[model samples]
Target: MQTELSKRLGVEYAVFGFTPFPAVAAAISRAGGLGVLGAVRYTAPDDLARDLDWIEAHADGRPYGLDVVMPAKKVEGATEADVEAMIPEGHRRFVTETLARYGVPELAPGEAAGWRITGWMEQVARSQLDVALDHPIRLLANALGSPPADVIARAHERGVLVAALAGSARHARKHQEAGIDIVVAQGYEAGGHTGDIASMVLTPEVVEAVDPLPVLAAGGIGSGPQVAAAFSLGAQGVWLGSVWLTTTEADLHSPALTRKLLAAGSGDTVRSRALTGKPARQLRTEWTEAWDDADGPGTLPMPLQGLLVAEAVSRIQKYEVDPLLGTPVGQIVGRMNSERSVQAVFDDLTRGFERAVDRVNRIAGRSAR
Candidate 1:
């Protein structure tokens, strides 16, 4: 699993683990890989700082990173309330009707929504970046695209490498031009927000498009064999997200959702705009179906769609609405059949990677090392 990127980041493997939980992030770093904490979940600066403090204390002197979701250009003067105003009355009616039809209960009296929608805002994301740069983070990545060139320069000034997620060769070239140190080729099969290209076609194209810039292959990767394949495609590393959701360290907060993920096959996931307004792959549920319905109000874009669904998402998870309850996940869900510790998953990946390498060696008329 060793590669130039791994060695440069002081990790034993060229695996970059992206997860929302601090425990999982620290565990990945401790397991000889770079753990990147997704920053979009942290809307408050103090909360992000607090979690970074925890990761630093528990990371065993290993390196970790932060992944923030912000648009390439700054979005100005767009408050949450302003975004909320843009949601049509029909969209609101649709959400209300869907929840009522599903028999999903509303939040209990005085119960907070349990989630906030400010993380995607430029102001909030900038606060996150401020806290992250103050920490000992080794890498700073943008989940949406390349942050402004000034942001990249800021990361470089602090001696932290900047990376961005790109779905196409053109996007990779853009990131490279923006001075991004690395580019993660996140394909259509990936969870959360992603693009239309599959990993097989996207990875090599990105690697070649940004030659001399390190590339991490993402999407539909969960095992050592997949890691080997990533390297064979000229990737300096592999970036993974969905494979971590079922880890014992993960806190998905809903047992029913976990069961749904475990039971899913590669064919079970669909790329829909239900989760984040963008085309993101997730479990196909009645929720997605409603939005995808021809007669229903179509989904909104970016912050608008996110704001529209925030309360409904909260209710769905709070009450565990079976048909409407689902989270972002990738096609790799088929292999995540049971809960396992982060360490155990890493062991499987390394062992599988070794076997894959040996198989390849034999195929080339050589013995296993």
Candidate 2:
């Protein structure tokens, strides 16, 4: 299960698990796989620093990475205030009416405020990168695009490797041009902001385009056979996200977990811009359908769309709004039928990789030679 990438990262397994849960990230790193914590949940620098402190204390000296989304193209000069101001009256009314129709309750006083759609914007992510560089992180990953030239230089100055997620070969090449150390070729079946290319078609193309630099395959990969398929496609490693959503360590809310377990299938998810401005894969829900409706207010772009629905999302989760409660998940959600610990998931990945290797050996048929 080891590759050059794993050796470079000082991990025993080349499996990279990208998750938002700090606990899940630490667990996977402790279990020999690279666990990359998604930093989108941490809008404030102090919050991110505190979480990294915890990860450092518990990761058993295993290296882990930080993932942040700073897109290459976004509305410039769009502050939180600007974004709020940009939300149309119709869109706001749509959110209000939808929540009312669903009977979703309002957040109680002192309840955690809904996530502000401010962090994914460049300014906040830059601050996040600064905080991440201050820690002893082994890798820094930009989810939406290549890291800025200065950001890459700064990470390199600290001996931290820079990785970026690419939806196509062209994007991979652009990352290379931007001096990215690693490229994660995430396919259409992946969770959250993805492009049209499927992993099977995208992986080998990215591999060839970014030769001499390692490419990690993502998208509809959940089983051992999928891992083997990724490697056969010339990927140096497999990056899994959705497989961990149902894990015990995952921070998914009860209603979301229930929906994931009882309803989600390979075909149950859809890619829509209803959640965030960009098209991202998520379980089908009334939230998405409402935005897709002909009579519904059309979705806004980027930070504005997220701003427009932030309160609605909070109310939906707080009240367990059944028809609209969903999270970003890939098509692999179908295989996530049961809750397991992070250690169990790691063990399964290892066992699956072994079985895949053995099957390949059997197919080679040494006796025939």
Candidate 3:
């Protein structure tokens, strides 16, 4: 069904699936939903080129988009090299020691090289934007904040629709000022980096604040009823992230993490700043618990903290020793019990939406009678 969002993006459905995996992106697009691939960690232009090319080939000509992080603030006068230098030696040592305590070992030879961390710098993000612009991406989404004026101007030049995520009405206004096409009113219940407000509260506030600018409801939206609620609240579509992580096509192959996600309930996740410097919702694990410990060394600032823990996080994943090594996720993980194909998930959602709408109409009819 074509909603205002579909019309705006020239897509077939208003269901927007976001992921870091290229295959997932292609699959969602092919399944009649818009697929958005997160390119935050893409450093080398060629890497992005290859990923986009792969998505284009596999997408069956269905439209897709790309996401990048453009934080509204940064350390003063910090160049890429300078940011890299700011990563403390003590933080690195702590990461290494923590991993060792958990029985995760150092990366082996070529493995370490392949897992090298990149793209946490401003220049690197800009470089990624340059590469993305050269392609035929239909939509460009900024995660952390509104994009730079130059980025917006350049995307407009190429006819790419720009979207940004906002946690509050204030942020929605800022996105409007930045000339963004869509505002994802992500609530505190959303996975990854999120704000303090719940979806039901944030969605209407953002919609009212940024009148005429389409809003997408995100955060804790995992079912058809949730989607209907979003539309009823005046959202043009829904932005989903955590719901897709447990999909069969997800890149998370680790048995431990998968088990945790499947077994988790809505209350299992927590908002912690252990991964990125910002408060992000993720599964509460031993690693995160350690960070919350009163006696432990506190976390550093954004990119510096990310860089400090990258190598150790890699080791944890390589060893398959723990489920807490990854980044943020939302409380919706509890509902993610099984790994269904992307198309199957979309079908279920569509069916659920229909049922929910029918129920609502019946209730309204009864009230009128």
Candidate 4:
């Protein structure tokens, strides 16, 4: 389970868990893998700083990382007002109408919209990254594309490793040229924004493209066998997100958790731009279906589409009864049928790795003799 990255990070395994919940991040770090807190949900620098403080305190001195979304392409100089102005009346109407059709209730008076739609903005993501660098974070990861050269430089200046997720060999080469420390080769089955390539093909391509620089295989990796497969593809580690959603430390809502348990299957998810203006894999729901409809207003790009659905999603979450409610998850969700402690999940991964190694070695030994 050890690799150069794991050795550097002082973890027992190279199992990296990426979650929106700090508790989950801290738990994964304590359980001997790198836990990466998804910082895209944090709109304000102060809140992110405060949470990182908490994670540092709870991590028991284990190294952890932060995940931010900074797309390589975005509307430059687009302020909040500018982004808001771009949302057409037709798109707004479609969102409202779709919610009504789903019987989604309205937000109660004075209830805060519990989501951030503009996290993809460069300014906000950089602000969060700046605040993160002030802490003891060992790693900084960009989820969408190669981080700005200055951002990568600043992280390196602070002795932080910079990692970026890549969906293709070309993307991985971009990271490699940009002086990134690691590239997470994520496949189409991964949760959240991903490219069309599958892991089986993408991993080795990225591995060779970014040779000497460590690559983490991501996407559909949810078990020990999957973990072994990642290593076989020359990945130094595995980056997982969806598998952690069902863990006890996850901040998933009870209703959504129940839906994940009862309604989710490997084939029950869809990649749609409705949630974030990028095709992120999430559970198949009426909300996604409505957005995908040709009759509805087509989706916006980047922060705009996310802005359009932010309030609607907040309302759905608050009501907790809408069947249309869903969250970003990967195809591995089908295997995540039970709620378990972070320790239990880690134990399972370790045991699975051992069993897989034993089986492989036995087969090789038979052939050798």
Candidate 5:
């Protein structure tokens, strides 16, 4: 699994696992792959730093990184409340009505949903970035595209390589031109905010578009054969996020969601702009259907949309409202029927890649190297 990009990052393999759980992230690195922790869920700098501390202590001298949802431009004074206030009353009413229809109850008075996606908020992102840069991180990836020039420069100054997710050749080119160190070609089949193209079509295009720069193939990939396919398409590595959601280390906190994911097929997931203002692939549930409804108040964009649905999601998950419960997941959910340790998954992936190589060699009438 050694690739130029992987070697450049001082990792044994080119597999880059994107996960939110620190345990899972550290496990990936210990298994000889890069584990990029997702930092968007951390609303406080102290919490993020705490997790990074734990990851480093558990990684056994291996490298790790964190992903954040930072906007491309600078917005110094825009607070989360300011962004929340931008959401229209109609959207608020719609969310309230939808929750009521689902029979999801409000949280006990004075009780707050502990988690919210705060990465899009500038203040929170900067705090997260500050905490991340203070660590011994090998990479800092932006999920919302290339970070602002100042952010890129700061990461570079700290000797931290920067990566950004790209969906199209055009976006890849822009990242390359903007000094991005790596490009993760996330396709429409990916879990979170993604583009319209599938990995089969997007990976090679991104690789060709950003020649010499590393491209990590993402979306609908969860196995060794899939990894081989990504390499065959010219990707330097693979970026896996959805694959870890079902792993034992993942703390989804809802058994219902885990059961849904385990039982789901490729078609059980849908791409809807219900989670965020932008279109993202997630599980098909009443929650998604309501936002996707023709007569429903149209979905809000980005931050506003996230705010509009955050509380509803909290309540749904808190009560495990079966019909209204869902999560952002990719098409790869089909093959994730079992919960295994991260090392077990890596071992299977390694074995699978070797088998794929042997099969290809046999087809070419050549002995396995």
Candidate 6:
């Protein structure tokens, strides 16, 4: 169905798939849904440009989008210098000691020299935006907050729609003020960075708060009933993240994690700031447990925390270690065990929506009768 969102993005359905892999972005767009490439992992301009080029080539000319983390508030300018300055000597020492405790080796000569905490937020994001604008991306989305006004203006000038993610109605209003074309009302159940509110309650609150602006429901939505509930609550579409992690096309999925996700319950995930310096929902693992322990060193803010753990996470993945590392995931992971194609996932959502609509109509008909 061509809802306002679909019309805005010139897509066939309102389903938006968010992922870091370019292949996933291309696949979702090919499947008649808007796929958004998460650009946070691209550490350099050339890296982002390459990924965008790959996505464009594989997208088959179908519309897609790009998402960047542009936090509304930061440590004022939050440059690499500022981040380095703010990182307490004790915190850096703690990071080094923690890695040593885990038997993770120190970086080689000239290896640690390139790792600057604020590179993504300040430099890389700008580079990504420049590359994305040159491409045919239909939408530009900000993950943490409303994008900078200049960024929004630049997108608009290039005839692209701008969207921002929000955890509350208050945040929605802020996005609206910043001239964001869409608001993704994410709840506590969302993977990665998220707020404390539940989706069922937050969706309607955001929809009501940002009347004319479209709201997309996010968090804990993996089934047809969930999509129907969001639509009924005035959402124009649904944004899905964790559900796709277990998909066959996901570049990051491993057999061990796939099995773990299938067996996980809704309560298996926890919101911890251990990874990103912001409360993000991810599968509970020894890594997360270690950070939450009072005896353990507390996490650093945003980029610093991310920088500290990047090497450890890479090592864990390189070693295929399950107990030590897990990626960001939501409560929806429990229902995401099966390995399905992107097209198959879209088909399931369509069928679910139809069944849910039919069930509602039947109930209404019975009440009338």
Candidate closer to the true structure by TM-score (higher is better), 5 or 6: 5
Which candidate number maximizes TM-score?
1
C-alpha RMSD (angstroms) for model 2: 1.8
Candidate 2 per-residue C-alpha lDDT over 1-369 given as tens digits, one digit per residue, 9 for 90 to 100:
889999999998888999988999999899998899999877789999999989999999999999998978877565778768877898888888888888888888787666676777888999998899989999898998898899999999999999999999998999999999999999999998899999999999999999999999999988788898899999989999988888888777665556555467889889999998789998888889998888878788887898788777877876777788888899998888888888998888777877887888788884322
In the range 331-367, model 6's lDDT, one tens digit per residue, is 9887886888888888898889878888888988853
Cα lDDT over the full model 3: 0.83
lDDT of 4 at 258: 63
Q: What TM-score would every model get versus the actual structure?
A: 0.98, 0.96, 0.94, 0.96, 0.97, 0.92
The pairs that clash in candidate 1 are none
lDDT of 4 at 146: 90
Cα deviation in Å at residue 252, candidate 5?
0.7
Query: 194, model 6: CA deviation in Å?
Result: 0.7
lDDT accuracy of residue 112 in candidate 4: 70
Cα-based lDDT at residue 166, candidate 4? 93
For candidate 1, the TM-score is 0.98
* Model 5 lDDT tens row, 1-369: 999989989999899999989999999999999999999889889999999999999999999999999866543447777777788898898898888887888999998776686777877888999999999999999998778889899999998999999889998899999898999999899998899999999999999999989899999789999999899899999999998998998899999999999999999999999998788999999889988999889898777788778878899999999988898899999999999999988998889999998988899999988
What is the lDDT of every predicted structure here? 0.90, 0.87, 0.83, 0.88, 0.90, 0.82
* Cα RMSD, each candidate: 1.1, 1.8, 2.1, 1.7, 1.3, 2.7
Instruction: Give the lowest summed-lDDT range of ten residues in model 4.
Output: 254-263
The clash count for each model shown is: 0, 0, 1, 0, 1, 0
Those runs of model 3 whose alpha carbons end farther than 4 Å from true positions after fitting are: 76-81, 109-117, 366-369
Ranking by lDDT: 1, 5, 4, 2, 3, 6
Q: Over the stretch 1-369, how does candidate 4's per-residue lDDT look in tens digits?
A: 899999987888999999999999999999999999998888889999999999999999999999998988877566877888888998898888888877888887887788976678888998998899999899999988899999989999998999999999998998899899999999999998899999999999999998999999999998998998899899999999988888888777665556555468999889999898889999888788888989777799887898888999888777774577788889988898888888999999998987887778787785322
RMSD of 5: 1.3
